[model samples]
Target: MKTKNIIFIYILLLSFSFAQSALKIATVSYIKGSCYIENSIQDKSITPLAGNSIMNNDIIHSKEDSFCDIIFDDDATKIHIDENTRVKILSDNYSRVFEVYYGSVFVSNAKTHIKTYIQTLNNNIYVNNNNIWVNSYRDFDKVVSINYNANIYNYISNSQIILKPLTAYNIFSNGSVKIDNNLDLVPDYIEDESYLQVRKENRNKYDVYLNDYDLIPVYGRETEKRSFDDNGFKLGLTAGTRYMNNNEYLTFGLFPQYKHNNFIVYSKLNVYYDYFLKCSSFDDCEFTESGIYSNWESKNDILEKFHLRYHRSDYNNSFSIYAGEIPQVTFGHGYLVNKFSNYYEYPLRSDFGVNIDWKIDNDFLNFKFLVPSIREYFRDGGIFGMHASLFLSHRFPLTLGLGFVMDFNQFSQSPRVYDVDSSIDSRQIKAFELDFELDIIRSMNLDVSIYGELVGIWYPENIFYFRSDGLMPFSDDLRWRRGTWGVMAPGVSLLIDNKHEINFAFNFNSAAFYPSYFNTNYLYNRSLYYLTAQPFDFNTLGFNLVGNQIGMLNDFAINSTNMEFFVPKELYPILTNKINVFPLRGFSIDYKYNFRNKIEYYNAISVYTQNVGQEKIKSQTYYTFDAKLSIKENILRNLSSLNFYVSNVFFLERDDREEYTFGFNMMFDLPSDVYILFDIGQVFYDVSLNGKRNNVLNSGLQLRLNF
Candidate 1:
């Protein structure tokens, strides 16, 4: 009897050894379209078939419109690969492991007790006897728990979070995590006919257990799950009317878009027809050459947008390029160019622009480039800028950035003569900036950083020639220097919960230097002159001089006798502060303040700030406050979305008037994917003389249909 028992034990040991030797990680159970397997060892690619064995480090890739299913050796564990997905099986240990580089996948371990791990760039998810959906992208990872709980481990923060059923977690590239609850965990693609057929066949052939909820057809949920696919063509039409500057225009536009994977082509064509109306009284016939009317007079009235964009990203790197009508561009703290838009005169004037951004090794290095207006480049000259940042170390979280911007011709859009006999040469203005940021504290809920920027601007010599002696022209050294420098140092930035942000900085500059020279109002302020010690004599062949006073040219002047009349303007140091708060989704408040010494300029070209009441100089403050609310999904029926914004600007020292702008936009959803958009706004412009302002009333309504 002892010998018989020994023989049975030996047989059992031998069987266990055989099972371990022939262990298979997983098997490809179903393939819908264009699915392939890549062998990591051999570097070979193969079109996979049903029953194909999946091994460690085998990469599974599904092309566009293609998907596949894999079943583990345990039979109860499975994964559904979505279109345009790439995943790798990393290990065949007791706890299965897979890494998702990009795209989406559905993991099913509902009927098995074995633990499964899904890893992404930012976080790792562990599941056991639970089904979950995971979508990984270059900058973020999204996870949804279907029926059971899962645990997400953030490697960066060293935190573990429990993901309950019907909950979604979004992990950003910066290691910040956001959680949302009460969501539908099932993806819409699972209900596709091909996927359904494959699941049905697999259930019968392999006798896999699928829940009733997974097999049942879902209806009326299509709208909630609607999303753009990899390939599509869509066209939208717009019909609107606008009233500005006592003139009315009927606007019509066509927007066409085509997308294929990471490449997209978009174009917009707009036409504005002048609408004539008979005036009943002389007071009703006020005419002004401002706003849209000026855009028409400039003859830039046809194409609004035409661009090709290509974007692609993975866990380690990303690249994107846009060639056409870039809406906005900013570089490095916006010291030189901030919120500069190529479409400043949209609907009437259009610009061709190019923007490129590239990131390597997950923010180890980043590069950005922008050409403000390619169309104007060859004709008149344009602005070109590039910025780069390098992450020094992860432990310290310090970043160093360099930026350069060149306006090939600062006088491109200015009047040719500028009341001078000889036209000014194409003045090339260049700016260089070096910035550094060090994070004092970085956490999931709060972030604090201190940054500084040292900037220098170079202006071309001979901005304007003045008569030093009879017929001998020389540049004014005292008035216009060749170069100037500024510093924005010891800036503090605070962020809370990824929703509220506050920034405070101290800016000091030389008299000739200007911060944020190329800003949102650059187009309007480009031609304005700077203020000089004395008012320019129109009889002499000299250019106008202006100073930077927010959006308007400095009108203050100092009078002096003799050629020694030029006095260097004492630059006032500024304190800049900004705050942005988002109390809820789609609602935000933004406030910005620029505080400086209140300087009074005398007719003798002297500058001084009053210090009568207190030892400190009096303060001149310019502030802008804006509040916006956008609601897309609300309890109100027929109201698809509503966007309302109110903005006010106070330049009390310069204009002594408050500029208020407010707009209300609403969209109503109709049948057949059609929508109606209505908008009305009151915009203020610095059109009147003597630092006065005028308000324009503009309203528009449009119909859009998208497919």
Candidate 2:
């Protein structure tokens, strides 16, 4: 009787515990410092604990019982997490993970880890409101040790472990040790030593992955060549598919060039598919705003999945460019601006036609051939637009002129639309553009861009005369005429920058396109209508500079780190709370040129934060300079072990910028096809681009396979 009673109570308790554990699916849990949704009413309610969720910018607490699955539809990404890990759930959107202070999450590779230490730097680093530090600064090729208070242990082959004070260890790697020194190998530990940067074999022009490897190449450079040193040129082709944020597309292109020392000839072709017209398919797709802009395949992002490309060539990256018509800037671009809600840019362009690119920036004069339209000439199907023509003009960071246009255009003359008005002048519209600009402040970089265009049109029948701009329309019968010409208009732009910043420019066009209404059979409160025919132009906001005219919310850059910001391991976890603004991470400032001081500057304040309390938000930020310098030492000469890279961040939304990022990274390379990769991203993901947040992760790896 007693045994039966005991068994009954035991079974009841066990069932209760299991039920409680299942409740976690409904509750929230965290991985590394990233957020994850435990369970939603719509889900099956059973998942792994380390997976990412679908919500961002929301908070959730840990419930020891929660479990979630992280299933990225596209497997182009990997994830990592750290130990003793504790971070609040900011957001866990499957594709867009974002958070503040979700320290120590490294993402890359193809797989994701949970609750693991950062493994990139391969050393432990600590951060807080005060300083930075590192652990056992040694080389893995040799032996290194952690002198526990009195006792000592040895590790062989090195099992790069993220150890903290009072951690116990058995045997695992080349050697073993019993940690007892209250030592905590942190990510911020730093050691200074000189190393050699031996020069390797010279990589020739054919050595790059530009397509054909067996061919020699040559290109004529004007002043400054691109990131190339060899003179020979090779054919470069690329076909890639980008799937990030919320858009997807496939693109393929070709670049053929001949180069010498002071001159060059090059032409190019590129085309792509945007797949479908969804709101989320374009760049800068957002939640607010309305019109066809809203309905046109609205999703998380907006993109022109499909575009064309062509170009000539130029040596100076500053001026003198030849790729496609639409100015060097208008070629192959979806637009030049971000969506009304989020800020982003379309990365490529299709220069309307082909043209010649010339330059005079670097002492010598240079020239290159911009390919003309071969598509229309080939009768490959039926390509009627601009004739395959080349552009020709002078050069200067601010100088500009006009170029002839004979390119192919299909989107227009929408054969998709028929007006029976098939006259030579009315049958075709050749594209042409005249451009000009002024450079006001070259230092802080203050400049304005202006350009105009004229197209083919017909009026007095097929009798040919210069149609206003002398543009002759291609008649179906070979001969051409005048009269049928499109409207003429102009636009303008400006730009600025720093190191980390690739570029920053604003453009506006007055009536680039017409108020295009995507009126279709799908009737509703609003049709996917484009207020302006032009792409992303400032004119939407009244700037009127057609084309892609975008306004940068903020443009700053953080290039390289001083490479010195870590504490020694002997101190263990004592100073784990210190943080630095310019250590492993980079930093840049925003500034305007000051004449008297002859300098550009930004706010001198940098804030650092640390998690002093048990809560994630317990961390606080304060501004300060480093109180200590890394001492140069040669402790471990031949042994390498753990590495850590860290960062942390806080966002003051009102400021429209991130307060700062404070964190670390660590990585390890082991024998065989294995590597340990780890990193902690502090405040890496702040604003939700396209309504999505970029969250930081603490990722660790067991091995890295080089294959």
Candidate 3:
């Protein structure tokens, strides 16, 4: 009887402890669409029904086009979960906390005695007021106080901030913060009628109590409601006149856009007419001299921009597709292609393009595909490629990727000039790359990744080599046929607080291959080989001289009338480095460096020998710098923004002249939904390789109206 009594008392105490540990902290009062609860202990998820119990450490997830309301055990405290939101509940003796992993949540704490805390990826928000909203995203976190005040603590910078009523605060991952005083710019979902109704019904049913506080103004609510009601169809018209070099032209454009949910359709139609080409009568006009009239000669002009875009993102999956005019495209670490664009020559030419991107489970698998010129693809050959990356593990992820790109017909751009020989066939160019990356450190403010890539470029045709044949150079037999390969090893990437990024890599290439072969300038440089190709002159081959090539030529002239020139074969032990900085909201800077080596031969002998030339290695370093500044927020009265950019390039030994470009653009807001825009640009280059340089200046002024 004594043992039985003791066992009974022990079991009774255990049961009571279990009951305390499993106490319900909240309940799902209302749900619209699919809502799920994830059991923290079992690691399983189940559809949450009405009045579902939410215990400590339980996670709630709301799917797309869904929302839910949760009534806490306090009865006076409640929360509304928006679509695509994940929240975890934590309870303690002192307070109840909601950990928002991503998405947005609205909290209404009517009781002043109860303490409510909202934790995010980078911030800990303590709600001291009656109504507030919190949002956490991959790149930033945001907080808005509707009726009262809140205190926020940043985990990255270890600082605290106070959020006042009718204010919004945005905290970026880089430890930068932006504050807005206007509540009208808040997300539209927060003001949805359905969500507000659900919150009201839940409060009434639960018999929640509220303390008197300052209420929002009637005019503010009316303004927000009117803004949403007026967001239907928008059309913009722009009329401008431009002066280039000594000629003037008229420009007119129409921009129409429509967006609903995750789908959007946008179109731009532009017309340019030369001032000198206009005549009193249509019959007197010369269509050949008019830019607008001549545009109809090509089919590409008709499809300038009819862009269609669709994007959808769920808790663990996202997909986006775009058709028409892809401004920039890159694959992998950009070993073979980087920043390739089809809109390089916007007004002068255009290309229809397509792009698709898909990501699953926080980059566990990422895939991308692109077509540079869809019209050219059907008419001739075009550029196409795909890239895919797979992450093996969630913790300590080791990522591997494969990339492939092909130019079906390299000569398709100018077929007539390249079809010189029948025997030299196969104008295809293809590249293959295999890459791997490992993250050494990933934290809230800093990330470091180490990566490497191996790439190969193939050309089916034989290599054309110039060889000396007596007095003149001649094309050698088409015997040497091989592919070029390159390697980028020991690369380091550093991202600091999402504001600054730095990259450094060591590149090695064989005889004929180069890194970033298909880059921003690929469109214009693709057909350059045809003009520069020449037969090798055997008589000009010579050994190294003690002085410069010009001095050596003088010596050669003193000895003999014939002169020899040094020819170099490019080889690599290349070093590349790039840095991008975003120090402020509307300002950025980018710079890159390429250090390369070239092998040269100097004349040391009177006659040509098999291997008697003095070999020399020279350094050719290339540098490019770009900077931009744009002010969108109103800093001055009636001045919308003043934007400008400057870019400069130093080719070192590659070119004799340096290149520079400058552009400026400004916008001013006028009365009655009207705006005035002014822009100017200048480009300096030596197109003919002569000593004289050419400067191209362009300026434009326009008036825009939005309706």
Model 3 lDDT per residue over 573-611, tens place? 110011010010111122222111011111110110122
Q: Write the per-residue lDDT of candidate 2 for residues 410-461, one digit (tens) a residue.
A: 2222111111121111122233433333333222123333433333322222
Specify the highest-TM-score model's number: 3
Off-target runs (Cα >4 Å) in candidate 2 are 1-375, 380-398, 408-426, 444-707
Cand. 3 Cα-lDDT: 0.58
For all predicted structures, in order, the TM-scores are 0.55, 0.22, 0.56
Q: Which stretches of candidate 1 lie over 4 Å from their true place?
A: 1-117, 120-142, 145-230, 244-246, 277-304, 414-425, 461-481, 529-666, 679-699
What ranking of all candidate models by lDDT puts the best one first? 3, 1, 2
Q: State the number of backbone clashes in model 3.
A: 8
Candidates in order have lDDT scores of 0.58, 0.26, 0.58
When sorted by TM-score, best at the front, the candidate numbers are 3, 1, 2
